[model samples]
Target: MGQKTALGSLLKRIGNSNQGKVVPGWGATPVMAFVGAMLIIFLLIMLNIYNQSVLLQGFSVDWNGV
Candidate 1:
């Protein structure tokens, strides 16, 4: 019973300690900045592609009434 409670407290402390430490390499400021920039560019590209598709779709429709 005592050992079990002690083990639980040790596990809880380990979990809390993990939140304080930054991961090596990937946590560097420059790497993070580059990743952020790439993400923004990716989103912009995808948005542009979607907008182009939507714009072209309207042209493909045949309006017989017009």
Candidate 2:
């Protein structure tokens, strides 16, 4: 092997077997979509808290005392 291809290079390459492979993941799940939607709601609640009752611009919710 060339000096440029050291053991560290070999180790790095070895762990990347799926680097270019199409892998089915979170985006393929309905549950993930639901969870993501809920996360957006949660984030919106927090944003309205930190930014004072406004979420996603113009979309506002009545957040009394927050």
Candidate number achieving the greatest lDDT relative to the actual structure: 2
For model 2, how does the per-residue alpha-carbon lDDT over 1-66 read when each residue is reduced to its tens digit? 546657878888898866888867755688888899999999988887667754466555567735
lDDT value for model 1: 0.73
Question: How far does residue 58 in candidate 1 sit from its true spot (Å)?
Answer: 15
Q: Which residue pairs does candidate 1 place in steric collision? A: none
Model 2 earns a TM-score of 0.38
| lDDT scores in order | 0.73, 0.76
lDDT of 1 by residue, 1-66 (tens): 345688888988888887867776755788889999999999987777656643554443335746
lDDT of 1 at 19: 81
In terms of TM-score, how similar is model 1 to the real structure? 0.46
Q: Which stretches of candidate 1 lie over 4 Å from their true place?
A: 1-4, 16-27, 53-66
10 residues in a row with least lDDT, candidate 1: 53-62
